[model samples]
Target: MGSNYLLSPYSLKGLQLKNRIVMAPMCQYSVMEKDGKPNDWHHVHYVSRAVGGTGLIIMEMTDVEPDGRITDYDLGLWSDEHIPAFARIIDGVHRYGAKIGIQIAHAGRKAEDAPEPVAPSAIPFPGPEYKLPRALTTDEVREMVRKFADAARRAVQAGVDTIELHGAHGYLIHQFHSPLTNRREDAYGQDLARFGVEVIEAVKAQLPPDMPLFFRISAVEYADGGYGIDHAIQLCKAYQAAGVDAFHVSSGGEGPAGERKPGNYPGYQVPFARSIRQALNVPVVAVGMLEDPALAESVVGNGDAELVAIARGLLRDPYWATHAAYALRSEEKHVPQQYERAYH
Candidate 1:
């Protein structure tokens, strides 16, 4: 494995990444206070990846409102008080030379701590712990779009290099985008792309023109009667038109237990990433069980994706990128000077 595309520099808008290896956002659910502010756990978790040589570190799904969180333990940006704490973490990651991004999201029908979760339809998530969601009025939906904009503004003020909207994993934006969850008869129903498009427009307004925007999407649902790749391509095109600069292609969080599960092999979602990149003509990130450096390299080398994200792999080894640079025979400069001798 030669030092190939995986270790190459990539720039989108004004953001420049040192390598194509990104630390995908994975929630810690460790917001010690019930107020949704990040704590020490998040700081160490992200900064460690920065020091390990990851090019971009996307923070976990941070909620826009108190009740919009997946759980009370999730991070948030609902108030100005939350700014300083996030700025501290961002500064730490930057100190180690890695750019940071935050995924802004709302849990919607899946909001575990909401007195009553809200959704486009009054459906219940298929689980005992989950409650039936109250359908949102058109006005409420518009308000949600506003909340997303405010959250993005707060994140920008906190000094993140980029903002990723968590439009996947059956969250609020995903709920509005999916036919299964968004059964509304009005504008959202007729146009599946309405909510997402509005959300993107709002977020972009709050960001500087040069700050790249990333959207994570479930490219294809895995259940019966669900949408497929074609639908995803169409939705992505709509999003791109709205304001997204890149797509983080992932799949299958909308289905029930036994359905079309995506392959578990390393780089299984690379094809989906490739399709989205080609169809939408934007940079895309391929993630999903890509623990092997060789496989990650191949995804980039084959032009399947511009970046590769490793989740559980990075959790198991924060230095996964540094080790990968070694495994791929990357330039010695990728290894931090103090730790360079250990690699040999």
Candidate 2:
């Protein structure tokens, strides 16, 4: 009998994953024509990983509006016309026996291509490439929440098994919550979590009742005087109340690191995932440099995270899940029949 926890099946809400392995959403930035639609490159890039053995594949940050994209090359789901393009890739992934989700997000002030970017405050991201963003008005903020819900509705029409909201990495949602970014006299500023809560409620209305909602969060900020694990815990509590079923715990990317530089080692972010899982009593996915098969297995085996996400590693190898299965001696590797001889 195989004892590889990484190869074990996991079920959350109505989403059932064949293994505890998730292909973390990494942007392709390859959307040609800048029309917010998936092209052939995206189709092959994602479907190959599904075929390789990833249990749950999260598509890259798909913006709710064209201007919300980090760059013209990024994907978007602002219109119903974009649904069929995504459905093609999703159908291909399903054929390989993998469940797929989309990470809906907005680049906010980080939008390099926006003629005039927007944020909670007028603060510009720490880079010359980024423009000083216009602060979103109270009415615009509410409209932004609606955009998230609209994009989610399009994702459902595309036949996604689940949806993930990008609340980390200094995006729109993160900007509103982080005290560093949001500084206003309005209700959203007074209540740091109000924007995120509203967005969550709005998106939830578009999702199926049993489809679990995943939230990607930065457990700690690396910038000087930034929020830490405790603050993140409180945020998670509010998010849990608002209806987040699971957390994909990651850290940093709020801005440049100060004295608190991010760790550059394996499992550097696992403890944060463990912290949230224990604090919120909810399943969490551990990410960041956790690609080694043994290290990945240890994360799940130790109960630190319910799942492990591979980012650059999967970019380096499409068949990472299968390779890990072999390394761990998992009996249910699920290698394709054509590749059985390679494993034997």
Candidate 3:
């Protein structure tokens, strides 16, 4: 028997996870009907990870509105009718002893398929293929907050163990917080985290008191003169006050990298996660190229972060958690009964 922190159990408020291994929410873009609902593809895609022994599975960026999606194929919780589809996936994940969460977001200017995308400012996403976005009116901004709360309400009905507000990766919440994107002169402009805080508070009202809420944040922007760790820490403090239980620390999705380029090596973002985890005194999930089993194990074992989110690694191998347990010589064998022969 060998000790492996990555395979150890973790608890956050009402959510109890079997291990520290998190299946990062990666968009599948497989919504065949373009109706903002999960189908067979999403069901299998997420459940297989649970069956493979992931501790937690955060579903991809599910939007609050139809036009909030990056593309029509993305998932959304705009209507009650969409609840059943997500419920099916969540139930399946639970059956395999994995907890599930949904990342609710709005694409804003990143809504590639919207006829007219909306943003905090009328800025394009620095790509020729992207369309210029119109700024949201003050009333529209308030309404957007309500939309986020509504989505959270529906997610609870669909039976998620927790909820994650996608405030990273140049999405709507990211745009509102980033100086590079939010040129608004309104209150949202003066207080960069105002939009995110509002959304957090609103979403909190819809969640169970014991259920923890996670905020996925870009620890630092890569654009020239963009906000760095100090700014991210301040944002996290405000979000923490507003009810964010933890943060998933990632970086450099606000725009293309500037003079300070993003790291392409493994565990490059772990330092940022560690910084935030220390500064805020909250648990964080370290992501970005942390696929190597040894590296993933180190992040948790070293106390850099409470969890390690695997993106492409889990994609390449559904049994990543099980395989990692074996590789690390963990005493707990995570393989399923049917797959016991293969593991042995």
Candidate 4:
């Protein structure tokens, strides 16, 4: 990659990367153990992306607790035992010269199989399968912060490159972020950002000072009563003060499907990433449908975001980064030695 912005090296605190193409965290939901342990599928799926020349491989949402999972099949790091299984993938990705991170999350009301799901309030996700969640007690809210911290601790022990807090897509953290869902009268209710701030502080305490922290946010809600991009910006300001090194900017998961829908086009969410990056003066990762190499490159070249996340595109072609280098007409050859014959 001959100095194209997308192929350019980047760093955040102590985490350095050879390029800026980040594999956005996408849930595989393939854990066969029911015990929240990653199996071979997760291993091969992530390693392929690394060997294909991805700079960063952020694993899918791995809940901090069992009930925090979107499904029973998702990964979890609530126990010390879960560390080794994750270490396997982290080691593999590092071996291929790619840094790895895991998104720690809590599904909250979105928990599908929880006998009783929990959220900022008692609202239920809109569906027959979704049940109204019990509002977490104030004390319980404090405990959840500790849970997030513990998950971060295990992530560090597992030797991952970074940590991205799953604060988007209408999960537990999202429930707290949006006023549409958080209606309590307590301290958490006093500030839409209290929960997120606490979680950030708690997680940071567990991490080394130089380890970069990435946070994902749904910039706006599609629901008629949802929060706007501005609200998310303010929330991010608080998180930035609490030591978030970067943000993964995305939009909408709090509303019912198609209610406050965003435009279906490449780089539609780039504006959100740009806004947060400028306003907070921190690096942001732009995501959402940015599959085109030219568009992804422009996003970086034009200085919209520090990095671009490719989710579904990487799924279709694990070698998207290498191909992107070719398409961008860069001398950046990310091909592995084994694939050199084919590339040449």
Error of 4 at 21 (Å): 0.3
Estimate, for each residue in 259-297, the C-alpha lDDT of model 2 and write its tens digit.
998999999999999999999899999999999999999
Tell me the tens digit of each residue's lDDT in model 3 across 175-286: 9999999999999999999999999999999999999999999999988999999999999999999999999999877778889898989999999999999998999999
- Backbone steric clashes in candidate 1, count: 0
Those runs of model 1 whose alpha carbons end farther than 4 Å from true positions after fitting are 257-259
lDDT by residue for model 4 (133-169), tens: 9999999999999999999999999998899998999
TM-score of each: 0.98, 0.99, 0.99, 0.98
Clashing pairs in 2: none
3 or 4, which is superior by TM-score? 3
Q: How accurate is candidate 4 locally (lDDT)?
A: 0.93
lDDT scores of the candidates, listed in order: 0.91, 0.94, 0.94, 0.93
Candidate 1, overall lDDT?
A: 0.91
